[model samples]
Target: MTGKINSENGYVKVEIHKVFKVLLSILLCFPVIGMIVLILIDTKEFSPILIVVMLLQVLMIRYIFIGLAFKFLSKDSLNRLRDVLDIEWIKNQA
Candidate 1:
């Protein structure tokens, strides 16, 4: 837990890193979002509720992908995230 928190820049650096990862993950889903828009446009029907629902679904999908990537991609960050969430991890001592 302490390892993830650095006193160097008052957490601004860590926060920025988190934000960058979130933005990058969302940006990665832009292609899918574009396809959704194209499909709606091609159908020649415009529904505000449908558009909102689709966008929300895309956001949740992006969030799930980002969570999985963080968990599998970087163990360190995963642990850090767990720490941030106040999840307790048992330590085994030999």
Candidate 2:
């Protein structure tokens, strides 16, 4: 099936999007894997600040992961507008 941004009679974008989604999921999963590994294997004492910082980093990655997953899953129209829709024209209309 062609996606919202597909070329007529060509499935390139859809194929690319499927591949992109898979790759993105994998990319997003790696951080969780690393965090789990650190929690499981790291015996080196980390300060409270360090633990908090690491947790924040994981949260940051997870947030991006969720946003990207939503964008990929949505049929284009459902996307939450972000940088791409931050039009200067609209912003400066005042």
Candidate 3:
């Protein structure tokens, strides 16, 4: 993904490329697709608990990617992202 950044009057504006947005949306759909396939393949044995667990696993995978991304960022950039997202737990990690 590519981003254009602009700052004015202490506010930061980030513009994400449309292609990047499309790619990201596709990437995010993989887990959902997998879940659908799983359900389709085993309709007779489908369980709500299994679906919930799969969803939790997908969320964990997403956060793992987010953590990895933060690791590659500079301290200032990480701080900026954490602040923008308003996620308090990230502050402790930083």
* TM-score between candidate 1 and the true structure: 0.37
Please provide TM-scores, in order, for all candidate models, with all chains considered together.
0.37, 0.37, 0.48
In Å, residue 34's CA in model 2 sits off its true spot by 0.9
Instruction: Estimate, for each residue in 9-37, the C-alpha lDDT of model 1 and write its tens digit.
Output: 21211222667778886786786677677
User: On residues 38-70, what C-alpha lDDT tens digit does candidate 2 reach at each position?
Assistant: 767875853456556666766776677556766
- Using lDDT, give the best candidate's number: 3
Each model's Cα RMSD? 9.0, 10.4, 8.6
Off by over 4 Å in 1: 1-44, 76-94
> Relative to the true structure, how large is the alpha-carbon lDDT of every model?
0.59, 0.52, 0.62
Can you give the lDDT of residue 32 in candidate 1?
66
Off by over 4 Å in 2: 1-16, 44-94
Candidate 3, residue 33: Cα displacement in angstroms equals 1.2
lDDT of candidate 3 over 1-94, digit per residue (tens) = 2333344212333344578668766776787898899899989988888878877767776667644654555446746765885654312222
How many residue pairs clash per model?
0, 0, 0
